[model samples]
Target: MHFEVPKVRMHSLREFAQHYFMIVLSILTALGLEQWIEHTHHRHAAEQASEQIEVELRGTLDSIHGALANNARQVAPLRTLKEAISDDVRRGLPDAQINQHIRELKNDFVLSVSWPSFATQSWDVAVANQSATWIDIDRLHKYATAYAAQRDASNWVTHDSTIALNGPRMVDLRTRINLGKDVDPVEFLGILQQMINTSTETSGHLEQTAKPIERALAEATN
Candidate 1:
């Protein structure tokens, strides 16, 4: 690299001191400008990242709300079906009569519980690209808490629906009854009871998760 030295002659100690101070001041000013520019760039990047993440979170929250509503709709009808079946069994109705009644109410006898898998691609990319490091710590904590809640609720639902519950048996019973095949009323009632219980619990966890997400979004807006 080529280097150039300034052509200067100091006439006295005072002149030399002034020249040295000027050089130091110029260097400091240059450094300050560079730091300022870098800080501005980082702040802008952080803002953009935050905006993208928030938008994605809004979509995720919408998905969650939709799922909750759908499950709510499903739970009500499932409960009604269970109650009807219970009554039929209580009245000591014949297997043929109970079977025919269940087949007739096939629409209400159906059970469906759907839960959302929240979108986190934006947040994940921000974290991976180090943009999250620029976010304020308090805000970052809030975001983290919201995402944590989503993850926990998702895991719980997965376990309850797939592992803990007798999902296969329930589906099989539902299919047989819907297809106009004979199913023991008491046995079918038990499965319907399980479905009602599982859906209620899933909705509870989803509602619990929603609270943190709602709070985070509200605070972020303010």
Candidate 2:
């Protein structure tokens, strides 16, 4: 019941070296091709993300400019209304004229106007898919900062413009103006001044936010 041992074949030293060399070459080639494919895929993703971000940023910049312009236009009329109310109080203008002035002020207020939705679709997608991690760190930082500023400015703008809607402010305003109810000029002036101040602050913030976005765009192009 004894078992016979089988003889094993052995390679010559040169043959062994050649065989290992071929194995090493095959592994290296496979690794190289895999790395090249991965590099290509990452590069393509970055390029696509960049293009989408660039277009979205441009649209955002335009929206900021338009919003700023509209905000500025509201300022002059608000200032005029403030002055007119002051004069009417000081000079004792008729109640009818006062009501008319209130109407004018209301017309100028432009409440309920829509602000531009900051276009962040591409950025959001990049972030959600983790593709933004592939971007240059410095560029990504700048873009992120710009978007943050945009978000803040938008919040302020929306709050300031629509704050009057929170209570009976608009309702009271319309009723008072329509009915020619006697409103204290000083009180109304304060409200108008507050709105003007909010607009000024919002516009300034938006302008500052725009600079970073512009910088981001320049960096992207360069």
Candidate 3:
């Protein structure tokens, strides 16, 4: 900035003081404007990051609901065949009769279960770029809690399966069923119980994860 030169040379200290303060005021005003602009930018960035994360949470909620439904559907057929086999064995039916009952109850059964793929891509990106730091403290905390729960659920799905499920035995059962080979009814019954237990536990974990995400989304709307 160029300063205005006085038409007449300054003849008093008062004039010089007036000129100096004008220059200082001009510099302060410019600095204040820059600070305001920076604050606005950070605020906008935080808002955008929050919006993206909320959208992702909604998608995750949808997947969780879908998974719960899908798993229920898978369990239905399992329960049906499990009941049939259990009844036949309790009745002291011979292996041939049990195998025939099983064939009729589960003609094309496939052992399978659905596991939801939880996502935190938006949250991860926000953190990587430091945009999450710009968010309001309370809001940031909520978002962090939601994503952390999602991660926990995902990890639990993996860890629980390894710890609680009999992978090799389940594979053998599935193979036998597929080949129409005779299965020991009592042994097969135990495996079905395991499958049902795993499915229920998985649903429990997903439901827990869904709670924080649903709360976060609800708060965002408010």
Q: In terms of TM-score, which candidate is strongest?
A: 1
Reference-based lDDT, residue 88, model 3: 85
TM-score of each: 0.89, 0.78, 0.87
lDDT tens digits by residue: candidate 3, 1-222: 455554657779998889778778888898899899999999999999999999999998999999999988888888888888888888899998998777676643445677777778899999998999999898898899999998787777667654676768978977887788988888888877887878877788888888988888888988
Report, for every candidate in turn, its global Cα lDDT versus the true structure.
0.82, 0.74, 0.83
Worst 10 residues of 3 by lDDT: 103-112
The ten-residue window of minimal lDDT in model 1 covers 1-10
Task: Flag clash pairs in model 1.
Answer: none
The segments of candidate 2 whose C-alpha lies over 4 angstroms from its true place after superposition are: 1-11, 87-106, 109-114, 154-171
Residues forming the 10-long window of minimal summed lDDT in candidate 2: 1-10
Error of 2 at 77 (Å): 1.6
Q: What is the C-alpha lDDT profile of model 1 across 1-222, one tens digit per residue?
A: 222335699799998888788777777787899899989988998888889878887888888889899999889987888888788888999999999989988788666787877888988998999998998888788888989998888777656554545778878887897788999888888777777877888878888888888887887789
Runs of candidate 1 exceeding 4 Å displacement: 1-5, 178-181
